[model samples]
Target: MKICVIGLGLLGGSFALGVRNTLDDVEIIGVDKNPEHSQKALELGIIDKIMTMEDAVPQATIAVIATPVNIIEYQLPFVLDLISPMGVVIDLGSTKGNICKAAEDHPKRARYVATHPIAGTENSGPESAFKGLFRNKTMIICDREKSDPIAYQFIKSIFKDLDMQVSYMDSVEHDKHIAYVSHLSHISSFALGATVLDMEKSEKSIFAMAGSGFSSTVRLAKSSPAMWAPIFEQNAENISEALGSYIEHLKSFKEIIDNKDMEKSTQVMNRVNDIRRVLKGIDIKS
Candidate 1:
């Protein structure tokens, strides 16, 4: 099988590595707008070769769009146009509703599968790629009924080879749920990081006092804006709703503390502590 992976950044490069490690007799072709990333992917042996979209799309058995959300919207239709009849196209974008809607009426709509693999690190670039990044991670396939059975099965096989757990949902529901579970968390992390940086101006020794908790909480803030900006825009409505709820809870907690209501503050902490039980069943390792 020959797979063409667009945008040889962290996700694409890591996908190439996973395929090479798990699949037999497979050729991985890489396409990236950045020459440095292409060269780095080659040097790191993440891809077998590099090719232009025009050349790679026609020959690939499967084409995976691992670009940012905006680029995925722009390229998906063009990719669907170029792929052979039997070829399958899949996307790894964080936001799915807009992307799936873009290709909804395309002539070859059945050839494309909308997927979001719920896994990643706060790192970017080809050098950040690694094997086993998708292992045990949940892969959400949006609007599955819109894709051809053959195309969907082929993608399922690929994710299974990478040891990922697969689930299906409508595109709208995927975006709504992810807004709370994924997008909101990133926003919180970014906000926390910004607050700390602003405080640093008044306290030079603030970072020196930071420990593992602060580092872990602010980790998502290191993610690339180039990638996340489009995602935030695409899911703005749902994310805003999630953020409003979060802010309300924050205000309630603050009020309790301000009133010196120790019992109420303890109840709030205990109630939120249930998340530990929920998280015990989630595999977030990358």
Candidate 2:
């Protein structure tokens, strides 16, 4: 089998490594708009070869679109138009609604599978790629009924071999759920980093006092703006809704603290403490 991974950034590079490690007798080719990324991907052994998209599709048994959300929207349809019916197309974009909608009426729509792997880092480019990034992660496949059974099975086989569990959702549900768990978290981290950096400018020695909690909370702020900006734009409605709810909760806490209402403040603390317990129950380190 031959696999062509479009966009040799962290996600694409990782996918290339995963497929090479897990799938025997498969050849990997990479496509990147940036010539430097293409060179880096080859230098890092992320792909077996660097190939043009026009030359790659006919020979590729599977096409993995790991580009940004907006580019994925444009590339997916073109891939479907070019690949054989037996060939499969998979996208690893974070936001799915727009991409799914773009493929809705395509002639080979069933050959494509919409997927979002619940794994990533605050890094970008082939240099940031690492092996085993997707191991033990959950991959959400949205709108499966619209996919061809053979193509869907092929994707599941690949992810399963990588030790990932496959889950299913509709595009709307995926967006809403991710807005709370993923997108909102990124926004909070970005805001925290901006706030702390401002404070650091005034308190020159504040870094010495920063603890693990602050470090962990602000980590996602280091994520690539080029990648995250389009994702946030694509899901603006859901992101805005999540942000609004978060602000309301914060305002309530501020009111309690300002009034010196010990009971109310403790009640708020207890409610927030319950969240830690809930997170613990889910096997998450809170």
Candidate 3:
């Protein structure tokens, strides 16, 4: 099998490496908009060769578009046009509705599979990629019925090779759920980081007093904005809804605190403490 990865960033590079580590009789070709990333991916053994999409797509058995969500939307149709008749195209972008819609009208839409792997760190670039990044991660394949049976099976086997758990959902539902579990969290982290930095400007002791809790809470703030900004924009409605609900909770908590309603505050926290069980259930499932 021949694999062509469109972006040689963390997800793309890690996927290529994972395929290389697990699959035999395979070749991986990488395409990056940035020449520096192509050189770095090649040097780091993330891919066997670096080639342009025009040269790479025709020969690839599978083309993985791992670019930012917006770029993926713009280029998905073009990639589908260039892919061989039997070839499959899988995307590792976060938002699925826009991506699926972009290629839905294409004649070769059956050959495309929209996927979002619930994995990553607060890092970017090929250097940050590793062989096992997707292992045990949940890989969500959206609009599976739209893809050809052969193509769907191919992606399932490939995700199995990468040691990921697979789930299926409608593209719209995928975006809505992710807005809460993924998008909202990133926005919260970024806002919290910004809040702390602003406060720290006047209080030099803020950094000195920072603890592990603060570091962990703000860790997603270090994620690449180039990748995330597009997601926030693409899923704006769902995100806006999530934000509204989150803001209401904040307002309620603040009101309780300002009014010195210790009993209500304790009751509210006691109700929210169920999250411990919710998280524990997720861990067990994982």
Candidate 4:
């Protein structure tokens, strides 16, 4: 099988590697807007070769769009136009509602599979793509019923080979849930980083006190702004709702501590401890 992965950033680069590793017979080609990323992908053995969409789309058995969310909106339609009847086009955009809506009524609407693999690191570029990034991770496929059976099966096969567990949801549902679990987390991390750096400006000695907890929380703040900014804009309404709720929660906790409401503060702490139970089921290493 011939697979062409566009956008050789962390997601695309990691995908190319995962596909190639799982399906040895599969030939992987990478297409990147950045020439350097293409070169790095090849040198790192993430793909068999580098090819353009014009040269690869029609011939490829599958085309995966791993670009940023905004670009995916415009790119997916063109990809659907290029592929044959049996060719499948799957996208790994973070936000799905807008992109899915864009391709809903196309003549080749069935050829597209809208997916968001719920896994990543704070790193990017072909150089940062790593093997096993998708392993055991949950991949959300939105509006599966709207996709062609063959296209959907083909996509399912790819993720299965990568050891990703699949879950189905409507696009709107996916967006709403992810706004709280994923998008808001990134925003919080970024805000936290900004806050700490601001404090450092007044007290340079604060850096010496930084520990693993601070590092872990702020790590996502180093993620690519180019990739995240569009996601924030695309999911603005849901993200704002999530942020408002989070701020309100934080304010309540602050009031409890400020007024020395020991009973209320203890109640809040115990409730928040449920997060430890939730994290226990996941394989994240602290």
The C-alpha lDDT values of all candidates are 0.94, 0.91, 0.94, 0.91
- The weakest ten consecutive residues by lDDT in model 2 span 277-286
lDDT of 4: 0.91
Candidate 2 off by > 4 Å: 281-286
> Which residue pairs show backbone clashes in model 2?
none
How close is every model to the real structure, measured as TM-score? 0.98, 0.96, 0.98, 0.97
How does candidate 2 fare on TM-score?
0.96
* Tens-digit per-residue lDDT, 156-264, candidate 4: 9889989988989999989999999999999999999999999999999998999999999999999999999999999999999999999999898888888999999
lDDT (Cα, 0-100) at 82 in candidate 2: 80
lDDT of 2 by residue, 34-105 (tens): 999999999899888888998998788999999999899899989998888789999999999999999999
Model 1 TM-score on a 0 to 1 scale: 0.98
Supply every candidate's count of residue pairs whose N, Cα or C atoms clash at under 3 angstroms: 0, 0, 0, 0
RMSD (CA, Å), each prediction: 1.1, 1.6, 1.0, 1.4
